[model samples]
Target: MIIELDMSSDTPIYVQLRNQIVKGIGKGEIQPGEKLPTVRQLAADAGVNTMTVNKTYQILKNEGYIRTDRRLGAFVSENINMNAEFRDKLESELELLSAEASITGMNREDFLKLCDEVYSKMKSSPIQIST
Candidate 1:
């Protein structure tokens, strides 16, 4: 998967990188146990600083999206845990998006339809990772 960064966007470079990686995993473009580029390699490819990639990797690790090994570097996690904490985070983000849709004059039905479309598009069959 290619990582694209918008230098002018208000979002931080690390956040953008993290989001893209997560989206890639969700879309199955980056499969579980797939190796990720090293911090320096990704930095060079994305034209961002190594620190930015490192930060993104750290965040992904903390969020259980990736795992790191001293010898192997980073790879997508085989099993992702969606515990209560994650559910709360998802709820918070959805609440904000729902509010925005309401403020933009999107009716409840339309908003739900849009949500369903996105969920369907991103959903993938269960992936089994080989060690």
Candidate 2:
């Protein structure tokens, strides 16, 4: 949907673009089967090169977040596959985050509350456009 890329950030442009698209899907802003903007269009709108957009789309496609066809271009995938590898990686990251939170004196309840708040925000973000 609506994407705002921070050019000054240390994160690569392609990664930021990919992450925003994933967030859009998770928030239901970009529904299943919805077509995304063409790479040239998105690149122009975001003030980035087409190659960057292509890289972002490729990553999304590989991760099962989107699909592409020669004639139809790219659309949101009907199903997202969160396989065992993804689950394991998520668990490991969560463990590290939880450890950091604990070290910073974040109690179990507070940490959970924070998670809920962030999740709620992500789900509620407005879906402005299909791009």
List the RMSD of every prediction in angstroms: 3.5, 5.7
lDDT of 1 by residue, 47-112 (tens): 999999999999999989999998999999989878777878989999999999999999999999
Q: What is candidate 2's lDDT per residue for 6-121, written digit by digit as tens?
A: 99999999999999998888888998899999999999999999999999999999877899998989999886766776778779999999999999999999999998988886
Residue 99 in model 1: lDDT = 99
In candidate 1, position 48 carries an lDDT of 91
Quote each prediction's TM-score.
0.93, 0.87
Q: How well does model 2 score by local distance difference test?
A: 0.88
Q: lDDT per prediction?
A: 0.92, 0.88
CA deviation > 4 Å runs, candidate 2: 121-131
